[model samples]
Structure formats: structure tokens, C-alpha cells
Target: MQKLFSLTLFLFTFSLSQAQNKFGNPEVDPVQIQKTYEQWSVYQNKNIMLSRDFTALDVSSKEITKEVFLDQLANGSFIPIRLKSDASVYYYKLFKIQPKTDTSIKATINQIGFDAYKNYKMEGTVFPKFSFKDLDGNLVTNESMKGKIIVIKCWYIHCTPCIKEFPQVNKLVEEYKDRKDIIFISLAEDSPEELKTFLARKPLSYAVIPDMKEYMNEALQLNSFPTHFILNKKGLISKVLPNFESLEVALAKESKF
Candidate 1:
């Protein structure tokens, strides 16, 4: 939800400006834009009002209603906005809208630019050594993962994009269920109780580790959610991906080696 609010700020900045419309030359209603901006500003950093709190049009001059926007975001039908931040303010860049006709604007949930990570040059580097217990009290350690392909996912319960990819991730787990050399793990920032409740509702196939915010932030130096890391048999990171499809491709290539 914090990620959603950050994205809302980015979108608001764009909508409130008088800059030319990036999607064609659609004439946007300035009066309505100002009204929507003021309404949203009241809730800035206070609440999540992304769905239907205020009425605003997309770059295509189409009304961005609640249902249509939420559906598109959930179905992975919208382009994700990439974000970067400094000590004071957050910055974001809009990706090239696909089909050149889609007007809906959406931001990546809990996603930060690669440069945001302390270990940005992740590939070919040895993953940090650590030991942690999963929900079932199974001790997982760096040494234990040696001589195998390890797939790790970093996410939390409230991340929309993270939840949206659960089915795809589960399929990957099922696909490799019989493989002895591959292991899938997920590091979540939520507490054990929150994770237990959420997992009961929507199960993830990965070995779930709870209360890993310190490990994720201090050890992993990650500022993004829904990030992935694939390590080879030597415990060296072979791939770092932002989406499931790319992780699948990387896994396919690594499994052969």
C-alpha cells in the first residue's frame, strides 16, 4: 500500500502540470484537473485513494474510472511506471505505452529502479551469507543452498503486483517440484501472523520466510518489492529480474548448466 501511495504522488504531479499531453493532442479540462488535484492533495500520504477518490482523465482524454483501472492493473494489462528516489523526493518515469492506443496510466507497485538497490550489479556476484527460519521452522542458510539453483522472491502482502503474480510463481514451483537441484524461496517483510492469515487466503508455493525486513533492507539492500534473484550452483547470482517471465527464461537457461 505504501508503494501505491508513492505512485499516486507521481501520477498527481503529472496530472496537475499544464504540460502538453504525451498521448496525442487531447484537450484536457484544466478546471476539472485542478479540482481533482486539490481533492487528491488532501489525501496525499494520508490514505490510499488511487481507485476512485478523485475523477481524472488519462492521457487519451478518457475518464479513468475505478473499476476499469483496477481491473487493468490486476490483469497486468497496464504498463508499469519505473521510480527513482533521492534523500528528499521521489522521481518516476513513465514507460512507453503499448499498442499506442491504451490510455490508462498505472505505476509499478513497490518497484524502484535498479540503481536504487545497493547491490545493483547483482549478476555474477555472490549472494550475501545469511541464516533464517521459514514459517515451518526450517533453517535455511547460504551454505545449505550451495550446489543448487536457488530462486528467491522479495515481496510483501499488500503489494498488488506481487500478489498478481502468485499464480504464475506457483506454476513455476509446480513445474520444478520434481527437480532436486532447484529450490524456490520467498522472503516477506510481513510478520508471521500477517503472513499466516494472508497465505491462508492465497497460498504461495515458495518456502515462506516472515519478518525479513531487516535482512531485505540491510543485507540485501533492496528498495523494491516483487524483485527476484536466481543463483547458480556456485552460489553466484546468475540473474536478477523484475518480472516472472524473465525469471522463467533465466531458470530454463540455468537448469541446463
Candidate 2:
């Protein structure tokens, strides 16, 4: 996965007192949270602390409340934070606030909690039964996907990270072009017309299904865009990954190809 941050700490450097003065109730503004995430690369692994005023969205694109956020600090949630200096880098994990008195809190990543969360939410669970028609009018469903390894990507036309991974995902499809037992597919939130226009400029190799907002939200209950789910031969989800690199690794392991 690409590290989403630069080494320039001065850009984000701020005083705790300064943050305290500006602190306010957590607002459910997806646009503002997204803008902040884009500017700071909030999901990156870094040795830094976020100010109390920092806003973060949950997987569903909803901003977490201050009270709930503080509760989750002691409990566990899939939020962005860094682990110990020696530990393997993790982007989103169960994080605890350090130095309780400070307005700027150091996030301590809890690897075990993260693993448990993944296991409960993704691994070993059957992929929800879905029926979708691609741009070519080909119908695909869970029944059709059984007996084959499936790699599914959920994304929208305007999501920057989703668009950024197109080239690499196309390469992934090309790499397995000859494989008969595996399938690559994408569920896009845009309409077929929009997708057709976009793909004409930036092509993708996966069988693209458009206008999948309902399925992506209701069936998958996904909180983030550009999420990848790898399913085994039995249609059981083997992994839920944030990036194509991680998806590739999961695919290789599941398919043994």
C-alpha cells in the first residue's frame, strides 16, 4: 500500500492549547471530514497526534460523535492510528488516546483488536447474495460466483483513491487473464452512462456493474469507498482489504494461484 503522507511534520504541527480553544461538538459533515482526510491523509501510519478538533468519519462516511469517539478510544473501533515504533505499520485499528490530559492525543494502535474486528466483520462470513447487471447486460449473482474465487471492488466515480487504483487493479486483472477459476468485478455507484464516459478515458479490466449504491450500502454495509472483498470458492469472504496490494495478497492466498 502507498504511504499517504509526506515526511513534513510542520504542515500538521499544532499546539495542544491552540486545539483546545478551537474544540467544538463533532458535526456530521461528510464533506468536511473528507476534505480533512484528504488534506492530512488521516488514515496513514505516522508518528503524530491529532488535535481534539480533528474530525474523523466512520466506515459509513458518517462523522463519529465526540462522546462516541471518546468511548471508542477506551473500547475498540476501526479508526486511524499508528502502532508502536517497532510494530508493523497499520492504518486503521483499535486506538486508545494517550496522555488523557492533553488536547492532542497520541493514538496507540491495538493490533489484536483490529484482527478481532476483521474476523467478526469479514472473515469466514458468507458474501451477501447480490444480483447485478453489468454494462454489457450480463447478470452476475452469488449463485454464479460460487465454485470460483471472486475479487469484488466497491467504489464510486468521484472517489479519488478509487480512481487512483484503477491502473493497478487493471494490472491485477491482466495478470490473471488466463485463470478460469477466478473472477474480478467492480460495483460502481455511478450510472452506466457516467461509467461509460469515465471508462472511455480511463479503462478498467474488471467486469463493471454500475449504479450499485443500494447493494453497496444495504447488502455490504460498507463504511468506506474503494473497499475490496475477496471471496473463496464457497462465496465466503476471506478478506476485506483497503487497498489493491492487500487484495492481491489475499487473492493469491485464497486461490493458490
Candidate 3:
């Protein structure tokens, strides 16, 4: 978890799954090290919160072992994220534990929601609001996405999976372009010059919006490319579709306005 801030890291952070290190212990080692992500999977789908105060106290005087994410107690049992290494470490836990299920179905939703959290509404409270520029360089707010069911595909050209998924995404866009009840947008992390020239001749006929790096960074806590979210007519985030097939399913499932 390379945080937006902080450059120093610790190596032994993941071994302490059940221990708390609130204050500081000078005896602990201090050297730059990458945080371990092994323990993250255990708490992935469980609603958990990160506590900076608790982490500061633990690693204050010693070398930090891993990067962690913090959340309000009310945020949710678990949150979606990439392997975190930068945010301040926060002690976390699942609000409600779920029973173990078979591996086949587990893999399906883990792709949908982190740690197989699809059955539960993540956040129970917050929804995503995007602010990006339209082709004309006008700033677009989350409210601009209302009225129509909006599908914003976060992507990059180099992404293998994304390249494979483009045609299907384009097809969905073409099918719904005339409906007026829905809209499709393809967003990429690359600069307009880089993406525009490449996609100009492609079948993607929807209005391609560009320059939302800051929005994507915050909403997904990810600088990595090719992430997308689907917004329902009520302006609530209905789905986070990270791939082609999933994106199609979300579009097909939209409740007609």
C-alpha cells in the first residue's frame, strides 16, 4: 500500500495478525521495507476499519511492517482496495463474519466485490461521485451523470484484459446510445493525445471523457488503470464493473427509467 504520502516502509508488518502495538517500542527494527500483504486476504471480505492512532502507537518507535487503510467504525465491515502500502496503518476487523462457502462461487464475487463481499452492501453509507472533463474540456460533476444510467469504464490501452473487453463495451454503448435512458463513457488514465489518436478509428462510438486522474485516484484508491463504476438513475453507485463481461451484465441489468 504505497500511500499518496510517505516513502518509508517496514517489512515485518504482516506477521502480527492478532497483536496490537498502539504506543511505540524502541526495540523494534527500523529499515525501509515493503509491507506484507499476506494477512489482507484473511480480512478481505470482512467489514474492517483501519485506525491510524492505533497504528502510530504501534509503529511510532519501531520500523513499520506493512501499509494499511483506515476507516470510520461506521464505514462497513470490509472495503475494496488494491494491495495497500502507503496509507497510514490502521487496526481493522470485520463487523460481521461470514461463513465459508465453496471455492467456485467465492471466486465469482471476489472479482465483483473484494473478499467475496457482493451479498452485502459495502459502505452501507457512502457512494461514489465522479468529476472529470468532457471532450470539450468542460468539467463534469457527478450530478451530470443523473437522468441516464451511466457506465464509466476506467481503462488504459496497455491493459491486456481491457483491450480484449473493448469490443463488447463498444457494442453495449452502441445498443444503448439511442435509448436516452442510459449513457456510456470510456475513461482512461492516459493523456487525451495518447488515447484519442489510438482509439479514433475504433468502434467505440460513445463520447469518451478524459482527465479524471484525481477522481479515479480517490474513488478507487488506485493509481492503477482500467477500473470502472456504473451509476444508476437515482445517482447511487449500482455496480463496480472491472471487466468486459461484468460490464455487459451490469448494462443488461439496468432498471429502465
Candidate 4:
């Protein structure tokens, strides 16, 4: 099924970069260290070639193969966020080794810094206006959101983390359902039929709009999956949370009731 395919892709992508082996020495300044995250390829029967961004950390073995690196990471030999200084090093493991042509293999790795994503505090900034039809064919726009605390979530059916947090999001919606001034809306990246089928098996309490990816991306400039935007009654952006847990905390503090 299409839904199953989406779920599989999400899991594969999440696990793919978590298998890479990259370690930073705590004794060195983070700025002095290089190759926090990199992609690599191996050609011929020779040596592994890392991308320009990568400089190998001094590890136990310098002659280890990519497979060996992955195996060690999977076996818990290397841990994420190993070194801390001005920058925190989180090594995303190499999850795959795919042969390209005859004599080459490509590998992917991610290096995330402690401040990779700086949380945006857009409070007092005017919320942008965008329109999309909810599942019930009701038009949802900034005008519709006026005089209310608007909670808008940008999500898709295939995102595992988004689905994992759906229950908590649903609970939050249920808790504020009775309040006329608080509205929870989900702009899903799926078509209406897809959402209908998916929701039949896994239901959510928020007002869901299907096939709103275009408007969500172009109008709201939201590209991140499972992003939440909270707007106050004055239509000002109050909080922009990347996950439902943070949204829950924001809701509690800025409750409209």
C-alpha cells in the first residue's frame, strides 16, 4: 500500500544516518576539529575517500573499512554527542554501503552540532495569511484564525516521528476542543483520499487539511516536517516548536482559556 511505503521510507531515512562512525576529541576546540559530518566514497581496491568537509578523527584504527566503521557504531562502540566545547559533536552513523558501478561504494553520514537548529522566537511578529480547505470543505485562513489562539502543524503521513507524537497532539487538541478561542489545525502533505484512508486506521482530533503542501510551503514558508506554529489572538506568532512535546509546553504557558 502507499501508506506502508511512506512508513518504510521514514524508518529507512531515520536509521540511515545514525550508523556512521565519527568521533571528535574533547581535548581540542570544536572550531579546530573538522569533518563533523561528511559523505564518503571508495574507488578501486585502494582507500576510502571522504568529502572535502571531512577530516578523520584520531581513532583506534586508521585502516578500517567502511563496513567496520558501521559495525562498530552499531555495536555501540561510538556514542553520539561525544565531545562538548563551543560546539557539540553528534555523529550520525553510516547506515548504508551501496556499490556504484564496479569499483566504488558510496556512504552517507550526518554530523549534527548542538546548535544545528536555533529555535526561532518570532513572538510579536505578524502571522502570515494562508488559505486551505479543511477535510470538511471549510476554508481555513488567517481571517478564520483571528481572535483565536491558532495552532498549525505541518506534517505528512509518512513521517514516523510525526506519527509517534500524534497521540500527544491529539490529546492537546482534545483538551482545548471546548475553548472557542483555541483551534488546532493540521496541514497534511497527503491527498484527501490518502488522509481519509490513513485516518480511518489512525485518527487524530485536529482539523486536518489534505494536499496543503503547496500552500504550506509557498505561503507559510514551512518546509520542516512536524513543525508547529502557535499564534496568539492578535495573530502574532507566539511560538514555533519543532515537536509536539515543545508545543504542549508552549500551549500550557500561553493557554487562551
Best by lDDT: 1
Tens-digit lDDT string for candidate 1 (147-250)? 99999999999999899999999999999999999999999999999999999999999999999989889988776668888889999988777667667867
Clashing pairs in 2: 59-223, 60-223
| Candidate 1 displacement at residue 175 in angstroms | 0.7
Mind sharing the TM-score for model 2?
A: 0.61
Candidate 4: what lDDT? 0.59
The digit string of per-residue lDDT tens for model 2 on 1-257 reads 13335434434554433443242322223223233433324443232222112354344334565334434543553344332222332222232232332222222323323332443356779888888899999999989888999988999989999999999999888888899999999999999999999999999899999999988888887767788888888888877776676677667667783
Off by over 4 Å in 2: 1-97, 100-120
User: Per-residue lDDT for 1-257 in model 4, tens only?
Assistant: 99999999999876644433224333333222222322122111112212111222324313344334434433422322123223322222222222221121111222111111222424558876777788989898888788899998889999998888888898888888778889888989899999999999999888899987787778666656777888899899877776776687678768934
Task: Mark the regions of model 3 whose C-alpha exceeds 4 Å error after superposition.
Answer: 1-127, 201-203, 223-225
TM-score of each: 0.56, 0.61, 0.51, 0.54
lDDT, model 3: 0.49
Superposed Cα deviation of residue 53, candidate 4 (Å)? 34
Q: All candidates' lDDT scores? A: 0.65, 0.63, 0.49, 0.59
The model with the greatest TM-score is 2
Instruction: Output the worst ten-in-a-row residue range by lDDT, candidate 3.
Output: 26-35
Superposed by TM-score, candidate 2 places the C-alpha of residue 159 at a distance from the truth, in angstroms, of: 0.3
Query: Which of the predicted structures, 1 or 3, would earn the higher lDDT when compared with the native?
Result: 1
